[model samples]
Target: MDWRPWLTRWSEEWIGCTAPDELDPDVVRDGWLGFAPASPEAVAAAEERLGTGLPPSYREFLLTTDGWRDAGCFVSRMSDTSTLDWVRDLEPYWQDWEEPDDEEGDAEGGPISRGLLISLEADAGILFLDPGDVDESGEWAAYSLFSWLAEPPTRFPSFIALMESLYAEFHEMRRPEGATRDSWEAQVEEARRHALAGDIDAAEPVLAKAEDFGLSRATVLRAQILLLIGRTYEAEQLLGRLLHPSFTPDGFFADPLFAEEFLPLLFAEHARSSSPGHNSILQSALIGDPPELQLIIAEHQARLRRGAARATYGNPEFDDLVHAALERHATDPDALWRAVGEALPRWRPRSTDHIAPVALLTHPVLADTLTPERGRALLSQPRGDHR
Candidate 1:
């Protein structure tokens, strides 16, 4: 794929953008959001010096612009042709990290010790491409590693794919509304409305975008939508991240729908999940909380100790449907979800006496069962709290 258009668009969008002190002065002087393109001779010399053919996509990228600026939140500079070198040459001890078994390489040394280091300036992060893992199209697999990430290094199929994802992160940070606080707030509210009206397909993407920009409300709203769609696993994943130790819960739980209705259901689900360390994660989130919130947390803990049934929609009608589903299809999880499909019309929103929370969207399994009339009924429910 052509790199010029992508780089041009990124540059155009980043006009007057300010970054950390790691920002390269060359980026500001070039007027292209990148340094001048490397000459064919310079590219050839790097290839000869490295003793390995550069991947096509990255080579094309270098010919377009020798290096990049602000590659991602942590990676401030992409290495120029002159600076490109092997990871082992720069950070030999990186081999101390064990390699993934599935990958074909030195049994002990992974991408960090075997790959080409492509990033020049980063905040406790490493970006590299593994030539040994080249695809049929000659694009090397790229890895983004950061000290703060507890998970394995994030991988992309190719150089451009990695760059595009980084560009998306950049856009998330500098939205068209111009980086002011709460720029994405309007989108979150609109998405909440869409989710309540049973247009979850419309709502989810917006909520996901807002969540990417670090809004706790968006994360909560999106997780509720995930649960409503019968995506219990996905919802729990979001909940796990939302309650991560680094996450602050200042403005969260202020919404009564979240505090009163959602938290109980979340705790009940946590009880059923029995995922290791989740209880500790929950307790960690409650540290330094006000007395009322502490009481609320204690109540959920007590209920879990008493072996409370896993809460579904917080409405008796819905819980009954879920219980019936469990009984009728004890051997087949998909069948139980299908039963949820059949129960959508009978399912009432827990907050209906007031207004809807994201809990109103019928499960995706309910897709086949949602007639136009049923869809309208789902959409027309009252939503959210008086406050």
Candidate 2:
């Protein structure tokens, strides 16, 4: 099938919609959608470098657009003709595969049976054309190779079939509303897919695009990406903004998917930081009466209690007392206060010198519940029965 015309039309539409002038120049440059078709010379050079004839369909794609982005394959960006240096780029991964033991009789001709890497996925997977697996037409079989998989390569009949399948998936993801072609929501969704695929770098540009467009969910997604990459401090800062009063609670926390997937990580990072600002943010997140926020609050407090116990006593079970109280009286302010009151005597001294309870009390949810006198009583109460 001649994919060039369809690919060209799609690429132009995608670039026209998504790559606004306000985006970072570097992002616009690196994004394959914004690139032009490769020169014939460049294509010839790449074929020569790989020492293999280029697949007709992919060669035509290069003529249409030198490289491409967000093709809906595992690959985040397809390589341009000049940059298709599989030998140099994939040699290390190819070498890393171990040779089969001699007793196994080299069933698949051992680790040397590697292919020509055509594109790179975010998780280090490669889409390659295996010369050894070519068809009668001399078209190589395309394989999706992953480092961790012990099974044989995922095979495609030809590069044309692979490109066609990816294009179909990409086309389906497009919305019916033309105005939303470059919408922040679309960008956010793209970033989410990249993040879920462990492609943090690929996700960043799209996230920045979302942020530039002032999408509410962008901050939450950024925090999620940051958390995934171990940038906890940055993640906490972003979450602080996300949970801030100015943003509507439903804007972020109301989504069950976000709440379930990201809230725990946000709360955990805030709890770990022990930052005053984070505690204030946590208080803000819990200030409302929404059932969703309430559940998140309970879970956050429970996590803190458990984390405190682990840090102080090397056993998370110590948090069970506090957990039981919160779980039993979650909806009743007075009853919850009493539960905290009862558990206070047992929890205070051990935790007072610690940061956990101090941080927890700073939040409005617990602050309004505990009076100065009650707090003092709990502090002065003997640790005898509690210990």
Candidate 3:
């Protein structure tokens, strides 16, 4: 970065060490970081490999200077400082970034990811980046930081101590001379950071037992582990109260509600085992908010449409239906299958594999009237084209 004069001054004064006149020229150079956004040249190079231009938004992220986060090695004492994670994906943009002058090739700067990513290894730890040198992808990786050095262990700061230190820091920040409301909020935020980091052992007593503590939120989060292990009985025991009155089912479960596994488990017991109005259950849960589960159901419906030829339909939650559909769709005879995108509640994305296609042949209109070739003709043309 040409802004080195001020950086050197600041680093020297604050870091208590000499700062280089320039960023290591090797940190971001030739476009090597895997999964990183690509520059125009890098994109041109990748086109040679993948055989297509990247999606425009992805391309713009790699080339435009909107400052998105980049992934890289984060070595820093400040656990809360997102610089390390920010730079993990952001380093390429930081170094390769240039401003375009003309459309051809006279650009002064290139694209930046989404944000400026600065990785500060611990306060006392030395930054191990090679300035601007890059791997094949044009950015640095966390592994290179260790591989480049014969002795990288010395650079590995005591992560546990650092975490404990953060806990202590927030403990202090939350309680200044007098405990004001804002201080209480700050304390909870720090606790939340620790909880997200899975510091249950450290956060339990202080967060769960404190008078103005964050027990409710913490409980819902901690219960996630139970949900993950398929111990829904236990998880439900922990979160069941909220389904009734504690955290407001709308807000407490908002996040996990969109998650494929957890959401199903949280409401598995509640969904009607045998019912119809339940179709609208998806509606109410998504009121003001959108229904993401609707996609899962629609996907299942898609699979049913593709799996049947004689209007043969059945349950999905049931195992027999699941196996039958799987086999039928595997050798689907009908060539006319309709792929539709039903509106979802929360827009949760699922893979095509899990979201198996349904059989339109099962629909009476097609099964009762149209033959396979006619169905094929129907499939070839979009409904809008015919209309």
Model 3 worst lDDT window (10 residues): 340-349
Q: What is the lDDT of residue 375 in candidate 2?
A: 47
- Best lDDT goes to which candidate? 1
**Which of 1 and 2 is the better model by lDDT?**
1
Q: For candidate 2, lDDT tens digit of each residue in 161-269? A: 7765555444334322233334657777766555544455676677755554345466666654454344546756776666655554354555543444445444544
Ranked by TM-score from best down, the candidates are 1, 2, 3
- Write down the lDDT of every candidate, Cα atoms only: 0.67, 0.55, 0.33
Q: Rank candidates, lDDT, best first.
A: 1, 2, 3
- Superposition TM-score, candidate 3 onto the true structure: 0.23
Model 3 clashes, total count: 58
Candidate 1: residue 57 lDDT (0-100): 92
Candidate 1 ranges beyond 4 A from true positions: 8-32, 100-110, 148-151, 171-218, 225-234, 243-256, 269-281, 290-343, 346-387
Report backbone clashes per prediction.
Answer: 6, 0, 58
Which digits, one per residue and each the tens of the lDDT, describe model 1 over residues 230-301?
565677677766655454346454545655565765555545554665453355456666465566678767
